[model samples]
Target: MSASFIEAMTAAAAQRPNALLTVASDVRPCTTRLAEVVAAGQRMGTRMIAAGILPGDIIGCMLANWREWLVVAVAAAHAGAVMLPIVTIYGAKELGFILRQSGAKWLFTPDSFRNIDYSAVVAGCGELSGLERHIVTGPAFEALESEGAISQPVDVNPEDLALLVFTSGTTADPKGVMHSAQGLLAELETMRLMRGGSDDDAVISPWPPGHVAGALSMYRYLCQGSPLVLMDQWDAALAARLVEQYRVTSSSGTPFHLSGMLAAAEANGHDLSSLRQYLVGAAPVPASLIEACQRRGLAVYHCYGSSEHPTVTSGVVDDPLDKQLHTEGRAIIGSEMRFVDDDGNDVPAGEEGEICTRGPELFMGYLDPVLNEAAFLPGGWYRSGDIGRLDAEGFLLITDRKKDIIIRGGENISSKEVEAVLLGLDAVADAAVVATPDERMGEIVRACIVLSSGASLSLDDIRDHFSAAGIAKQKTPERLSIIDELPRNASGKVLKHALRNCS
Candidate 1:
């Protein structure tokens, strides 16, 4: 798409070396310019090669959304090595599994983060035969950046493996998803076009860099010359402040983040006029949230995608209010979408089916090729495992995940459909629907809810709300648990598997 990640970075640095890149932390925001970040990456890449990293070698990083994480990503790409960004939430058990599974030869992490002793975690990973070095950030890492730049960055093909991101593994162990330089950049360009980024645009990425979205934010800074504001920890008040302070134009997160930021802004009387578009996905978006954003004069829209396919469909700011609110928009340029039944046959138009996509932005395959067999349908289409239907205008309405359908007394209930109804209620702040075991009904809808502040709701109240919505009686949540918050992975998707085990 742009030659490669490093090529894009190098070109952008030459064009906009003074562009700002800020990292917001608890203490203060650390800001740097494009030239400095590129120089740091080049130095680190040289040091990596001096330490024996080769093309295609996997370098794993288990860090938060720190500035150094971006530098290391650039370093990895510059050296033609694959970057494996492990989420900081992962412990030694999960970390060990990923390192061993990915066969990563190098790892970069801090000694500790947020009171978690990552050095101890690395020590506890036991003996990893393939691991050559585990470099902790500090003097050791700073020394690497002090090295002289490489005479020449390694040349890599556009299709060479450049990124290895693991799924959130809400159900099973995480799978190592591989992405080539071309695929990652293609997705980046699609997003850049979707957001209508410009040199004047400033983006605040609240996601952890270990996630694909975060990685792309860093690349967007290096490649597109868009100023980036990164947050290590998610604080709604802080995010609201940063958005106003920096005049951020575009950002993306789940409904949880968007709602929280809006609340924080309202509480502090902060005017978030700088924000132009807030791209939302990775969870079921509530229509009320969209309505709330609209009331505040914010452009919020739904986007549908996952790790395997970063972005399949995304709504735009100019779409009709109904389309923007109700559907994840049509396929972006260069992407194709199809619908298929469980039998792997094409479903008729307007019929719900598993969403299949194939395009330049699609991932090559999982690192564990065995997992790829079931991941893709015949004819190179990647099975997204999500169920949705296309409208006459090509807008996609995602009903539920294939696994998310709750069968209650032989009737299929879309969890999102029920959750949408629940969210329409005044008291319900956030909700997640899961299938709970039942003695006679096979499985019933169980809703875990987070209520609004100073608001209250009972099972009967929820039932009444659903009754008012004119939805099927069976779709009403048979079981309800009002909790503080729904469990979420880094990308803000609900951990439905964890909820299934909850009593």
Candidate 2:
């Protein structure tokens, strides 16, 4: 287990470098070849430190989705620095915490994406006093040239930090999830085993390359000697065109993004028949949505993953849409899953408990020692903090997040239960339930929602829908807020804190 992911990537790069790396809808080569790009990373890594950037430094990336991000990531790892991904989702406040906590010495960001001043954010980071160098990934940063022939990375080790990934936590602050070169690569092995990629493969995605999925594709797609097509932003119409035009075999995104693609398919009537897989995850995919994809001739594959443990569940072609949409499939080979109650005892089949796992896919640990110990419990099992159950078919069904459960009069009411019922109504496009302060019940269920097009829905309508679904009248939403969109993290999990603030 070398500490350099770029070293492993070098194998693929040497085999092929001019293969299309990224297809940006503009028909430009996203990557010429894997080897050359990685070699460039090695050279860039050497130059950055030569130009005074420190090794093992945390380099922040606050750029939009693009191929350059992938290049920087490889370069960072080759340079022996940890790539601290600062996605576009971070505000200046969230930006400061990640930069300061990761102890970033160099920062790379766009001058402005649309209207937001990312450089200004980097300048603002200067206020926190950790960032020493600022390099923009987009137009603002000066063009960078390779310093020299890619020097082999220095004595790399298995447990060294390769990336500092920030994942949302129950606590107000997001923690930096650390992944070693071996740990992250180990996680990708699960995807490799499941995908069994080939040289003829191609990937279509709008998920930003800054996160793990984006990182996963950097290797997974390259290993197959395939081309990757990327959309800089979530433009469904553009993405549909890429898939149709490129004869793309597969696409990936959160359920929200997939829903956007679905809408684009209806509006533009693009010939997505060329598409084979529309992989969806990060949020629950409604069975109805899965059925709709089937009607549209797109194979909707259910994939559930988090930044902490990417690509956990995947629906197969053989699985019925109901099971696909309902159960995250059994753990892939090399992964083990178990359900444990409050006492850490294994729960009986069909009983609800937190899903715990031990596999090559889990993150190395949180960057902070205290947090790592809590996240990875005794016996090396990582507690998912997600409530789930295993069915007779051995498929895992996630019930709700441990935090998303509403404690109403000390009775644990699953918000997912409320959402499931609400989504059953054709008018309800999506729903999220949270516990709000209440005088009588201590906390009552409140739903923030978005309705489907051409559907007129009211609070009572939603309540009755839940009632028909056999949901307890008490667990039904007492208050409702209709909105255009829910706040979601990079992984597509709804950001309830933002929702809670909408009072």
Can you give the TM-score per candidate against the true fold? 0.81, 0.77
lDDT of 2 by residue, 1-503 (tens): 44356666666677767667654633223545666566666677766667666567888876655656666776676677888876664555567777788888877776666556766655554476777777775443324534455566655565787777775445445578777777677766655556544656677866665566666676564433467777666677888777777777777776656777667877998777767676666555567778787887777776655667775667666677667767887776667777888778888878999888876667777777787766665888888889998888878888877766565533346666567667788888888888787643556789888889987887788767754543445667888888998889999999887887786
Top candidate when judged by lDDT against the true structure: 1
In order, what lDDT does every prediction score? 0.82, 0.69
True-structure lDDT of candidate 2: 0.69
Among the numbered candidates, top TM-score falls to 1
Which residue runs does candidate 1 get wrong by more than 4 Å?
A: 27-29, 404-503
Residue 66: error of model 1 in Å? 1.2
lDDT of 1 by residue, 1-503 (tens): 34977898889899999899888886335889998888898899988888889999999988787778878888998888999998776666558878999999989998787777777777777779999988888888888888574647889998989999986333335578899988888888877777775777898887777778777777778877788888888888989999999999889986767888899999998879989889987666678889888987788898887778888899999888899899999899899999998888999999999989999989999888888888888889998888999999999998876656665533345676677778888898999989887644557889899999999888899878765554436667889888888999999999888888887
| Cα error of candidate 1 at position 178, Å | 0.4
Candidate 1, residue 219: how far the Cα is off, in Å: 1.5
Lowest summed-lDDT stretch of 10 residues in model 1? 166-175
Give lDDT: candidate 2, residue 112: 63
